[model samples]
Target: MTQTQNTTHGGPDALGVPAWDFSSNANACGPCPTALAAVQQADASLYPDPTYAALREAIAAFHAVDAGRIVLAGSASEFIGRVSAWTAREGGRRAWWPAQAYGDYAQAAQAWRLERTDDPAQADLAWLCEPASPLGGAEQQAHQVVGSALQVVLDRAYEPLRLRGVCSLDPVAQNHVWQLWTPNKALGLTGVRGAYAIAPEHALTEARALEQLAPSWPLGAHAVAMLDAWLSSAAQDWLTHSLPTLREWKRELCAMLEDLGWTVTPSDANFFCATPPHRLNAMALRSHGVKLRDATSLGLPGQFRLSAQAPEAQVALRRALIAQKERVA
Candidate 1:
């Protein structure tokens, strides 16, 4: 293992929850009622089936994949670390990920001492994320990267919340790489930590290795309930219906940033990156109970990732921005 520092994240911080926060990529319209109710009603008194037989079957049916191909994880981050460790343990020496991606990818690589390489062809493992984080743009080189790497994992954490554009990878290409899905963010239930990965076709050996590496009952009852709810027609319908509202909110967010003379980057997801007209006083904003995700940690300095929020939250953010500007002036 390698020495590492704590990674920065966007949710509630040491100051506690911000009054208006645009730091995390969670669905602003979420904690979907259906999913929430399922979690609330889950039987916490009992441990879920050790094998998660029924839950795995349900998720597999939803994706139209074999039950044996489903790999349950405590969360997406947990899977990242496990897979990276698997790569290193299998005599894999190098890894690669998107230019801008979740920090955990790199952190996992470091922990496994996998040499970081910019060229996917030279790597034993490669990671991809569509509507890539911090930038929220399509991964243009996905095909090349997926084709080159010996083992690949595509993070689809934001797919359900995608407001525009389609997945860059077609079904055929997708089958060549692992598809990691974290429905908690989309269900608006980030507190419910659960995720699943679809093993690439004929990759049973590797899939079993991952399953063997996992501790028993990786998902708790609440997580199992939440994920089950996510596959329901009611929850799926709710998600589809929420998109238009999110699109409108995103429009308002972009317009507000543009009006403030901030450069907003176009994105297909609910979140996008923006650069303030002046230097951002993040601490001052936090003091005012407002927070934005600083993109510096994600290799995109001078930009902040802002998720589309409701009108009231947007208004609060605008006022905070104006106040911070005046304070700096």
Candidate 2:
């Protein structure tokens, strides 16, 4: 049975594509030309190396870590589930994550029947993300937990797309937690579905165990190509260049929402949550060819999470909201 049938996400929905989609935090300026070319040229007919030897080495070099620390996954969500399952298998009873975080963290814990706890000190496993999802803010108590013996997974999916602010964790602290990297969002290639985790410096044994849980060839050829391209100078440069445009668009988005009487939440990343002057009817907006991510599933009800978009799309969203209000009036 599929657990995701009820899972809430912000991209294209059952109604098809939205004219203006702000449901996801993907880089609005991409699909990166370099990464796209690599995916297009991927050798789909041939199987990727069962061990992914060269790919793992490249990723290790990119992060300047030992190859043994690189644990490949089909995607970020897949890794979340894998690690949660690993914790459960190893006799872990409790898991902790930020009050508001990507739903998969909770979903995986639930699937593995791990009890949820509010206190990280009491938890056998913990999850943290920064420039966090929905809020696009820092993870509370990150520094303390990162260095502790508690098994921690630090989702760095949005770090590359950070428009403002610096990571609170220093390099030394970062080496103590499992650093999960999903470059698809930064490259604006979310559809590619590739991700990896740099295990803590002393977690080689844990990393090997997690690898055992994975199926052979967990990442397909397209995913391999996408990740391989993700490490290239061209793709990295393109991603770096996209951030300023995203930052400008984020400013415009926040300004536009504020002008419309929405209460915008401050964030350091490319997205933020805003509460409309009145209750938001997401379906009504969807009918108007606009799709916004309702933060209800992300534990922030009555608010919407919007990723930065180009000016034209922003204008379209502005128009739609105004039109909706006028029709109601």
Candidate 3:
């Protein structure tokens, strides 16, 4: 939505395949070889010690925070779950708000015995999908939550805009415990299953309690290295270039969907949510080999999520949807 055109990543340039909206995180700019090399050089003998220490420092430095405030996690979900669990036990109630966004938040509330309410005033914690998970509400609602520069677990899974200005937190301070960045949707890093959490001291302390209770959640040697490489200078530069390309691709996909006369949400990030124009059922789409998600598992409905990361996947989705329109017509 920010950039106007998508000239760089058209057909085969960004992906070897011919699709644009795939589930794999191919839309991301990070996770290239520039980062993979770091994985190889990682001192495996020291195991979690060196990797965790190095990761803590890198994350803290990247987010501009004191090293002591940083907490590490193998995955962002682990960090969030720990926090939610702690809140339930300590706060004696679920920090749940009656809002419709990411389902994980509600699940956390339910797990911790939090109640959902329509009134924002009654809410103590808000689990926002920062740039949002393709539903497109986080931007407007964020200011209210981060009243005086609020804290966030920014999931820059597909940062359309460089986090500098867009993030609600002290972008320079790295105050929030940002969740994991994987290649599944963008760089094909899903198989590797590596993720990181960047958090302030208190949040880290709370989340770390879960780790002490369950040490198995720590990241493996290579996965942590993969994240480290992306944080490296050369990799960052690559991201600078790759992000816009993804932006362009996303824009193009939305336009094409609109042109087809199907009611599609205008998406700024890599994906959009839509029910077929005729109010088509998503279950049928899955049966046709299109295989769209119902958003219910992730907490959305009549809407499907697409990965704008891979050009081939998007193109494939476009074709599939276009064909579906004809069949329904």
- In order, candidate lDDTs are 0.90, 0.90, 0.53
Instruction: List the candidates ranked by TM-score, beginning with the highest.
Output: 1, 2, 3
Question: For candidate 1, what is the lDDT?
Answer: 0.90
Tens-digit lDDT track for model 2 on 1-329? 12122116878867787888888889999999999999999999999999999999999999899999999999999999999999999999999998899989999999999999987887889999999998998987897666553799999999998988888888888888999999999988888898999999999999999999998899999999999999999999998888899999999999999999999999999999999998766787777778888888889888888999999999889988998888778
lDDT of 2 at 325: 84
Q: In candidate 3, how many Å is residue 260 off? A: 1.3
Going through the candidates in the order shown, the clash numbers are: 1, 0, 29
Per-residue lDDT of model 3, residues 259-305, tens digit only = 76656765555556665556544334433434443454445545555
> Candidate 2: where are CA atoms >4 Å away?
1-7, 147-149
lDDT by residue (1-329, candidate 1, tens digit) is 11011115788766688888788889889879999999999999999999999999999999999888899999999999999999999999999988889999999999999999999999999999987897887888899998899999999999999998899999999998999999998888888899999999889889999999999889999999999999999999999999999999999999999999999989999999999998887777777777888888888888888999999999989999998778778
Give residue 157's lDDT in candidate 1 (0 to 100). Answer: 96
TM-score of every model versus the real structure: 0.97, 0.97, 0.75
**In what order do the candidates fall by lDDT, top score first?**
1, 2, 3
What does candidate 3 score in Cα RMSD to the true structure? 7.3
**Comparison by TM-score, 1 against 3, better one:** 1
Give the per-residue Cα lDDT of candidate 3 at 4. 11
In model 3, the runs with Cα more than 4 Å from the true position are 1-21, 24-31, 37-46, 148-165, 168-187, 200-217, 281-289, 297-299, 309-315
